[model samples]
Target: MIKEKKVSSRFIYFFGAFGGILFGYDIGVMTGALPFLQQDWNIENAAVIGWITSSIMLGAIIGGALAGQLSDRLGRRKMILIAAVIFVIGSILSGIAPPNGHYFLIAARIFLGMAVGAASALVPAYMSEMAPAHLRGRLSGINQTMIVSGMLLSYIVDYLLSGLPATMAWRLMLTMAAVPALILFFGVLKLPESPRFLIKNNKLDEARRVLSYLRPKETLESEINQIQEAAEQEKLASQNTSWGSLLSSKYRYLLIAGVGVAAFQQFQGANAIFYYIPMIVENATGTAASTALMWPIIQGIILVLGSLLFLVIADKFKRRTLLTLGGTVMGLSFILPAILQKVIPDANPMMIVVFLSIYVAFYSFTWAPLTWVIIGEIFPLMIRGRASGVASSFNWIGSFLVGLMFPIMIATISQEAVFAIFGVICLLGVAFVRIRVPETRGYTLEEIESMEESRQAKQKSALLERAGL
Candidate 1:
């Protein structure tokens, strides 16, 4: 038997999930900083402002793809370290951009977005691989909790800094992301590599040592055997580990479910509410910018509180069931306000805020966290990194389009119409979950993979029988 230092499970969970904090902070910080930046730069063009806001997502698209491939080669922990370094660099550059440097700021945010995208892809896989199957959903769900907490932190920071000089306030808000990035960097240095990754790399002794600490003593050997078997099967069956292999019949369903869940989560437009809530509130209620800014804090609070609730139900509930219910409620929340406006013709503007709160409440506990949870659980180990990158890229693509277009869409169409469109997408998301996604709750990663094989075998047997073979 090989010996290794035992790492704290709590520390592993906290730091493994900590990347979400930076991801959430960068995303939320811009919401508060955008108005100040636009004013200080004397920028009146909505499209230009939209580009500045959405540019990080464009970079995230690249970051997810790059990190996914790199992590598969370098290990998940190393990729996270690289991402933290990039986040620090990006945050500092964003803070120091000179006057009328909107282009520079956009470039910096795009650079920062690369880190955010990498974290978005890396954290779920890391947490999933580290966690016991029984606790994987809740353990993976911790990343979501950290994300909302970071957003809440950013909103609070924005409020505290808003009273400063416009130039100084936004800079501080943007640079604050570096603080957590540094923390994550230091903490991750001591984290053990994922046992599953170790097994795949032919580091069986290291895998066993890591698993000894991660799994119960009585079951540790059995767990090691399961992972070792899975790794061997994958090595034998997969001749090519390229991205193209994901398109084969064996993996096609997993890809559709993984990528579709990821894509739809953003397409439903939660970030539109997050990135632009202040603007949306100001437009609807005719409130001063300062008062409008307070709304995000409220939304942030609801999000954090709701995310806490998910830690309770994550393992107990079926993935598809929570998704279906949350999507239904979210769809109705958006659609109801539109209908109320049409019927009443002058519904209380605060009614829009109330509906948005409801939407956030449902989303925080449901789709927001569960998307990562399901994606983390569903993919096979051989392609988990590349497939996750593909899913994360699709997610960021939707987020980028939604972030860039919400302003433009609202300008050309009625706000009511735009929200109505999001409502329709949310309902469509529910249908997608019901028809395409599988239930992976209460199953080990090895068991889930085997379930897929059994499913494909049944389908093949049925077809052969029908042909009288």
Candidate 2:
């Protein structure tokens, strides 16, 4: 037996979760840079502005789909390196994009977005594969923490660099992504290929080698065998089912629940509310939007704090309990504003801000991070990659539509009414979780897969009886 090594799991886990930093940086950097870019280019079209801001999400949708399939075929490590390289190239290209070359910048942002999407999908799964059963939730939760930290980093950089000449200001902000990208590329080179991937490819000895480092010596052999058996079962399951079966009744309900939650999370307009917060505050408070300038930093802090709370409590509580509680609170936060607006027509706009702040804190503690945690561990191993991609795609689609439509939505309907709609969506989110979603917080991925398969078998039996087949 190979001797057990005492490596800092922290180093491995942090490197694995490093991709989240890139994801968050790309997301937050644009928020600050967009204003300068608009002034420099003298752009007046709202559609153009929206396109520039949302191109990343659009690229993410395409990237999520491609990364899912590629990670499965090419291996997780290779795909991560590929994403880092793409981030570097996209950042350099975007920073140097010439004045009046909006299309070029959009393309580069989309290119960077591809990396963001891939990282978003890959990090959770990759971290999930390497983490011990007891630590999985915390490790996966760390990925979210990294993402939030990156956003805060970008926000700080943007505020500090605001005094620079506008031309150079945004360029530096856009190109700053290359720093983390390079770090990620070099860092991943030192990590092992996922042991699960090695097992799936029939590299048994190599899988053992990886697990020897990943697991304690005492549990190493058993862990390898457990993963190996899971891989074999997945292969057999894949052989027995075609992709078409997923589209058919065999897996329809599973897809509906997974993909539905994914989409609903985004569609409830969290991002819309966030992206337009300054404007929203302006309307409510009857004050200059600049008064809210310090607020993004505040919100970013909340996001970071919320993610930290998740890391601490992730393994401690029941997933459904926290989710249900968070959803109910998030719904009420928005709905109460509408009720107040109707009841007290002249209610102070600061009240709206207060409720929104509450919403943000609750969201940080619940839906924002948990959405990723659930999707990361919930899918069966056989189609985990593809199904994750689908759910991710659904998420980006919701993001894209909401980003593109929210301004129009506000114009067509008053902002209060628009927020009311989001409130209703929140309640619906609660129903999905309470009734349809399963709890998988403490279970191993293989065990979760087995449980889902057993559930599917029962569903099939019920369908056959109902059809008299």
Candidate 3:
């Protein structure tokens, strides 16, 4: 019998969670910074401001698409390095953008989107690959936590710099990203490449070395053996299939489920709130716009706390159950605001803020992190890169649509109507998760793959028998 080996949670946490910080920071930073950017850049209209806010997502759509293919070819570590470079460039360009040309700012936002897209795709994959089976959910959940933490940091930065002139404050906010980017670049360089990547590249010796560092010494050999077996299985599976096979009747359902979950997460209107909470607060409170902007920071703090709660409980509960419950909560949150807005027309500002706060908290606890963890862990390894890209692309596409149209929607319709639409979408999301998504909390990647292979073989055998072959 093979011996079981213990692993260090610290090593996994440090390396895995670092990438998430960037994700969170990027999410939080832009929301607060946008008000200052708009003021400084002379963007007076809401539509233009929305465009400026979403430009990064448009870039991210492209970046996420490229990340999967590139990581598949170049490996995860290298892709992260590339993302860091893009982030630095985007940050610097955004910070120093000339006031005369809005296009420069748009371009810079797009560049940052690319970096975010790449990191979103790669970080989870890397964390999933590195984590021990028992700790996979918790470890992967760290990515989301870091993302929340980053969002919180952005809020703090924006609050502290709220007093600065628009140009200097925005520049300082954007440039601060460089500090983390530098740290991420140098820190990642010191870490070994993923053993899975090494194994796929036919560097068995190097794979073993990396595994030794990743796991306890006693478990290294068994882990290496397991990885090799998995690599061989993946290679064999790839021999007959291409990306086209993802559409085959047998595999198509999984793709739909994966992509649907991803799309719904965005459609639930979480990001609409994220990208425009400052504006939303102003609308609700009739407070001076700058003071209203502090709402995003509140949103960020709640997000961090909610995500932390999810991390503690994620492995303990069924993913589908948690997702459904979260979705329902989110849907209710959206509807409450819409109802209050329509009924009262002039409700208390504190009441509006309280409901919005609850909405943000619900999103953080359930849908935000769970969606990512599910996407990263659900697919078989062979198609993981391509499939994850497809899912992430769908996510970005949904985010793009929401970001692009929310300004127009809010103008044409009311904020109540916009949120009402989101409420409906969240209800649909809850239904989708309830009906389609499977529980995958305790299963190892290897075990999940085995189940898929077994199912496929059984199907193939039945087909052959029916044909009398």
Best by TM-score: 3
State residue 204's C-alpha deviation in candidate 3, in Å: 2.7
Instruction: Please give the range of 10 consecutive residues that has the lowest summed lDDT in model 3.
Output: 1-10
- State every prediction's TM-score relative to the real structure: 0.88, 0.86, 0.88
* Backbone clashes in model 3, listed as residue pairs: 24-147, 25-150
Winner on lDDT between 1 and 2 is 1
Query: Model 3, residue 395: displacement in angstroms?
Result: 0.8
The alpha-carbon deviation from the true structure for residue 344 of candidate 3, after best TM-score superposition, in angstroms, is 2.6
Pairs in steric clash, model 1: none
Residue 10 error for model 2, in Å?
2.8
Tens-place lDDT digits, model 1, residues 1-469: 4345689888988887678887888889988888787667877677887898999999998888788678879999999999999999999999999998888988998999899888887887798788887776466567788889889889998988899888888888899889999999999988888888888888988888887887778998888888888777767646557778898887888889999999999999899999988878877887755446788899999999999999888778798899999999999998998999989987788898799899999999999988888887899877776787788778889999999999888888878788889999999999999988888888876788787788899999999999999
**Candidate 1 to truth, TM:** 0.88
What is the model-wide C-alpha lDDT for candidate 3?
A: 0.79
Error of 2 at 128 (Å): 2.6
lDDT (tens digit, per residue) of candidate 2 on 260-294: 77887887777775555655776677764434545
Clash count for candidate 3 is: 2
Winning candidate number (lDDT): 1
Candidate lDDT scores, in order, read 0.87, 0.79, 0.79
